[model samples]
Target: MKKFICIISAAVACIACESRTYEEISDNTPIAQVVTYNKDVKAIIDANCVSCHSPGPQALTNYSQVKGNINSIIDRISRANGDPQKMPQGGSLSPAQINIITKWKTDGLPEN
Candidate 1:
């Protein structure tokens, strides 16, 4: 009985210590898929950025604007959490969302 309890406790400890890597979990767009502005990046920007990054001179509301500012977009979004220069002001995007933007740029900024 004591050995059974010890084994169960050991199993629980191992489970608790199991680390979850980003690639281990699913993302909105799979890494294997080709990321595009319209398909993956647009949604991420719309949901996390449009509120503050739109309807202004520095708007990111359209594909053209986003593609034009890809460098800055990637820089700002890639900032560490709590960074004063981090984008979207108060919040941050998920790792998957960030990856999508990076991959989009790497993929030559596909519009469709």
Candidate 2:
């Protein structure tokens, strides 16, 4: 009887220690710097998107092209990053790369 009680108590204690879904996990993670067009956006575009999207049907190489088609850029980013129709033909871009493009579009697609 005493062994049973001890086992039950231990089980209850373990169960109590288990994390609850309602408990919020603190996001102490530092916020990453936003990606800008001149610095980060161009690289991502050049590496992943520009092959098919530059000076052709898509054309996302320069600021003018990207800025002019900001909406399309955003749509493609969202789809490629979030949904199933990702760009770059084969693989997906990293979160950091995606963030850079997203930030650039959100920041008015600056020239510099």
Best lDDT among the predictions, by candidate number: 1
Off by over 4 Å in 1: 1-30
Q: Put down candidate 1 lDDT per residue, 1-112, tens digits, no spaces.
A: 9999999999999999988865467475658878888888998899888888878889999999999999999999889879999987887777778888999998899998
Give the C-alpha miss distance for residue 90 in model 1, angstroms. Answer: 1.5
lDDT of 2 by residue, 2-45 (tens): 99999999999998997743213533333366556777777777
Candidate 2's TM-score reads 0.58
TM-score of each model, paired residue for residue: 0.76, 0.58
